[model samples]
Target: MARSIFPFLLLFLFTYYYTGVQSHEEGYVTAEISNKGLEFLKDLLIEKAESSLVPLELPKIEKSVKIPIIGSVQMVLSNITIEKIHVTSSTVKTGDTGILIDVSGATANLSMNWKYSYSTWLLPISVSDKGSATVQVEGLDIGLTLSLNTLQGSLKLSLLECGCYVNNISIKLNGGASWLYQRLIDAFEGKISSSVEDAVSKKLKEAIPKLDSVLQSLPKEVSVTDIAELNVTFVDEPELSGSSLDLQINGLFYAKNEVAHSKHYHKMLKASDSCNEADKMVKISLHENVLKSASSVYFEANKMHWMVDEVPDQSLLNTAGWRFIVPQLYKKYPNRDMNLNLSVSSPPIIEVENQRISAIIPLDFVIDILDADELIPVACISMVISSSGSAEISGHALAGNLKLNDFTMSLKWSNIGDFHMHLIQTVMSTMLKTVILPFANLKLSKGLQLPVFHGYELQYAQILCTDSWIVICSDVAPVEQLRLV
Candidate 1:
């Protein structure tokens, strides 16, 4: 999970440019992380720190020292490597400026090959001793604060301040005579400690800018379908409190084939801060505008139109079945096949309220007759379909359900002349119930996707509909433990 989780989680951790507080619901999308996620953050950072420390080659330490008894002694410690690291304590919190992470009371054990050559002050002979040694580093402390800001629609991170300190270091020389051990420790202990402190602090500073760039590289908009894309750009600066961090994003969808948005004007963002504390690492909130935009996209692409020539009852498409209601239509195209063409007059309007979700769809229904091996328009009817929308958390998406409430129908034009409106109403309703509703319900069962990234997918989730938005709570745990809110 760490592969994508680390970058994405850290990206969530840093919330930039908090706006003032408000009361009403305004944001289209909001993500919140509580203290529970902070605990996970600490552990993940520790693992990341350990991984970054290893496979790091420390520069070789070489120096020449002149002693009273010995002429000139040259010492070199090469092939240095960190063998193990233990983080005994760590703390992370959000500050006024940014996020601060402190790791202290840590220990680092290192191993390096040491060689020394000495020329005696009195004798002309030179003695050389070569062996390996281990260094025990104690009381290692690291402190860092990162500054976050949005740069042209991306989050930018920078190391505001960083510090590393090593209280003491002990070096044990192995192959040389016992007397040389004390002399070597006295000369190299201070140098090794300082090098470690400098190296760690420098590496962290250099990595901050590069990691910042990675966060900035995330896509501003996520594609939903061939013709639709969700605007995932930040709508407002992030807000970080003592207990959690929150982000607001433009969650509305748009037609990708054309540069356009729904008629709804974008509103100011307001992250949900009313949720009680929970173990959930993330809470995502989606507004009604998201649904509105989806309807617009489908309508703009002409995807809502359907040429339904087949149905569960084959006789419904033949002129014999409608002869009694529209006698003229049957006389004109006797015993012929028929097709109903359905299309939306305009984009459907969806509104969210206490009693589920209500929608009004204006649709055009046209009848065509097959005559002389050609399809010919026979009649046209206008209708307003009314339905209520419902959603449930199904796996990674919020599955949707639509149930038809009622509809009003009228004749627009008819080549068959006049017909009884009452007789056709009953038949049309049955056709919709047995044919149109089933097809629409089937498609809606697939569900609407939440905001998602390329490499990461949401799991162990539950949803709740409230006020003007829907709340999704999910965990990073295994799927078997999935629970509902």
Candidate 2:
């Protein structure tokens, strides 16, 4: 019985010790595998940098990883196909430090062609890091992209410690234009450049305090330092359209979880002059029926006002530029103070497809000064604007027939005969004839009578002529008057 008992004890002890050893060894192996993966990532990043149009260099690698495994493993990856590859290196030490990263040889190719009204993104990145003998890491980068819009930014810190200097850490991104453009826009916005430096600077300034908070929360064992500078450049300009944009950005970032650094840039080409001015503010509040594709649009200007304060320098570029016709309004109401209160329920409904515009516009006009005189004030020149068809206008001058709401004016002036006849011909040939012929021809007539005013009989009591323009002398105290010219 003693002999049997001794054998059983020996077997039990052996099994217990072997199981403990295997558990410890498995943990160690998992750590090593993770560290090797980090090294491989670093190497991959170097390769990408070497092949890029704008290469980058980072100072160090800071990372952490966790994995579940069965046996010892060694991973050696020769070549892996990826849409984009990135690398960042940061120093690992005891206190404050700098970070640097080198990025190069990142390539992007459209994997599949599918048109989408609204697009999204998915980012996959692999991370590899080596630290103390007890811990190791292998990681993949994962992120999100939605359409070709833009990205904000993110700073990740691994709260671990180690004296072992990380040599290489690589990150890879794989996606289509939807993901690429958003990332590029974000990175470009992150860098400081002359084109959009102010916008990017403001962003960085706001981010610095958050970065400091991250640094302060790091674990005691980890000492992060040595941040490397990053550079960003684009392969091509991002074409901003409705749903699609093509672009790419290559850059590097280097910093331990305990250290903080950031870069930002903003670039805008063909920017409007109104973008900088603050005094001229425009506020557009339109109903939902304005755009077919949009439910509603509310545009507010911080500096330049399109209608009230000052006309936009390049109003033509605005989406609603045509609605607020600056040139026509300027010429029509020069030196006049008018409150532009015009609203429309819908765009012109063309009864005829190619030649006409039939829109329902609720109009209200206030004219302070007519010609050079400030005494005449026309209030509420309101009318429903409903017109269509195109008319061919020609010639320089040809004044004859004119009519306005039961009122008629004719002319016989010889003092202005020297002016070009082509003006008269062109003015009468087109829509302007409604005003031009009545004003020009009526001025030469012996006398004129205005339509009734407040049921009171008021007629043009006098006529005054000058070398350049014509004026009507009315005796009924001009309260609300409508002059075609």
Candidate 3:
């Protein structure tokens, strides 16, 4: 009669224990990476630009002029070298349309050799000259319009301002006659200025595509394990500010083989009001649904198990009431002749309520009695356990500490002849408090973490839990050694 009523008793206890507990619906997560945390990106851009835009060379320039007194005047300039280019100031603006990068107060220095010859038709006299000149450019302004191409996973840069002014010019006439000095200087300046503008413009256009290619090659999806992959998709147009840029991302966290085959598209970036002073550098908000989904995945994968087979001390057996129920058995067999296995009987159910996270995990516990000849199954118990906990940021990962608040158990089957049923319950409860629950807490403490960025580190992180989601905000800064991806 007791065995027949066991299932109903177990159900009643579980229902009564979880009667007022709340449940949450599963969903996705949204992350907002603020601009204040993006200072390192500006420095990186400047460094890459300086190293790439150097030793710029222009092809030989030739011009012919028909003069009345000196007929068929021909001029040629060759071997032009732009040795130095510097960017003094930079500004980035974000709007609904796209991002605008304004680089101003730039400077460049150029040097080239020139040659000219003219022949007089009537006098039959010919004159030739050669000279070298240095050109200094200042107040250079360059503006670029940046946009993301979602299909290709790349950034596109277009010229907004491609202009500069001549700060100073020095001319050294090696062989040109004194009478033609002024005329030669005027001609050289015109040709060199036009050539320099075109060369710089062309280089800027070429470099951006290469940069896009490099960014595209970076892995978009991070594999957490064989069973899970986190798809980090940029869901909206990026925003740029004075100190940093913000990217709106949606993480499509799913189990392996569960991802959609169709391509995912991002919404266009809409302009937002300026950020507040208290805004941190890196901000990420995860919806409660994400965690709920992960729990389901873990349950489906059958990965939740807490097992203990170590030999228990004689004291523990005695305190657990095992000696009282089976004194003769313990006297004949050692404490090492026992093993315990606990596995999830059903998927763990997680919910957030009362400013805390809670979970109800159904468990199956099997106890085996080991003999010198063979191992014999002694008892099987079914348990439903509940825990409540809070989450904290430990290093780069989120750690959780859960306390086992309540549980209900019932005997499924038992082979221990003449053993008191209440004694088994006492032993199971003792083992749960001493061994099983602590191991579960240890596993929960490891928690989950975000992927690390190569050149940046996170600090002063704050976590906030709301009705819909959890938000993590942090300040990001450059490390001493920048690791390029």
Candidate 4:
């Protein structure tokens, strides 16, 4: 009976103490929950703040919810619009204990026509589409996890066949060389990246020392990983003509310090890939259509940028300048016949430090024109131009054989009469020697000098007197001359 009584007393004491402890615990939870909402709100503000020592203003702290088991804090905010968002201060409440803080807000005066946007730069830099985001905070670091969902603009990267809209955008760069390079490539290739690159490059050139200082502060073995996914609604209509391309990019890399800081860059060109760097880099391809009436004399480099060592020739352009002259001559005058040959070649290389460039033009062809009946004899007309810039022209025509040295001329209607005049003169002179002289009433030696009027005939008729009376008459029947010797 004594032992049982002692056990009963002990049980009563234990029960009283346990009840008291439970009441105290409940009070602590209640107090903690009440204060936790503000704490979590502050954490979100801190995460959004871009600068330290900067205070953020919110209209009100509406509500805060805390989950004791998971140690998560969710706070709803009012009139919470930050001029800028940055990752600044970080605090850890306890070792090995996880705490998550989240803050969210909305504005009544938002313009539906415009996109909402947010961005932050820190160890984990991120930018988002324009809209409201439900930020969930959960991690062991006692920091806020920002989940930003917004209505972002779609990226129209290249002049391709696609119609789409984007509602959100984000960029997260985990430190690495490959990741950094790819981020830079995408950013540069993206709508905003080109401008950003230009600005940065200009600034770096101006502030090399500052850039070096910043680079020095970073890890030498920088490995960057990034996941940039774009949410796009591709518009495809049967009546509309266009292809669709909605894309996301994710990449990783493990590079050494030396490789990370490698000075051997191919100077990332605009649209073309580096030939030498092909093995060291990956490529993303783009597609476009070949329009039926596109300009033929296009520069390949314009499409390929710096990657193309050689540029296509424009001299063969069928629509302009010299080329136009050939085709037009043929098309406009169906009665006249014309032919053309035009070609181009690369020029010799002239090397400069860190650069080598060459150019060539192959403009080689002969053109011949003939009358409708082909009565005119064939002519051999040629133009020869050397890489050294020497030009020679040689030809034969009814105008007589011509040997031209760097000679250039145009054949027009006015010149045609002069050419025919010279030709006619030549043919007439030859025919006179071969035919008219032999049939004329004059005999002449090959080397004899003849009077101009030697071919005239004179006739005199004379009636003879008994003795020798002389009578001369100009008329052939009335002439009288002594006579018949």
Ranking by lDDT: 1, 3, 2, 4
Instruction: Name the candidate that leads on TM-score.
Output: 1
For model 4, what is the error of residue 135's alpha carbon versus the real structure, in angstroms, after optimal superposition? 21
Shift of residue 139 alpha carbon in model 2, Å: 25
* Predicted candidate 3 versus true structure: per-residue lDDT over 43-83, tens digit per residue: 57766787688889987889887777667878887888888
Identify the leading candidate in terms of lDDT. Answer: 1
Worst 10 residues of 4 by lDDT: 20-29
- What's the number of clashes in each of the models? 0, 74, 2, 28
lDDT values, one for every candidate: 0.70, 0.24, 0.57, 0.22
TM-score of each: 0.85, 0.17, 0.72, 0.16
**Pairwise TM-score winner, candidates 1 and 2:** 1
> Ten residues in a row with the worst lDDT in model 2?
20-29
TM-score, structure 3 vs. true: 0.72
Q: Over the full model, what C-alpha lDDT does candidate 4 score relative to the true structure?
A: 0.22
Clashes in predicted model 1: 0
Select the stronger candidate by TM-score from 1 and 4.
1
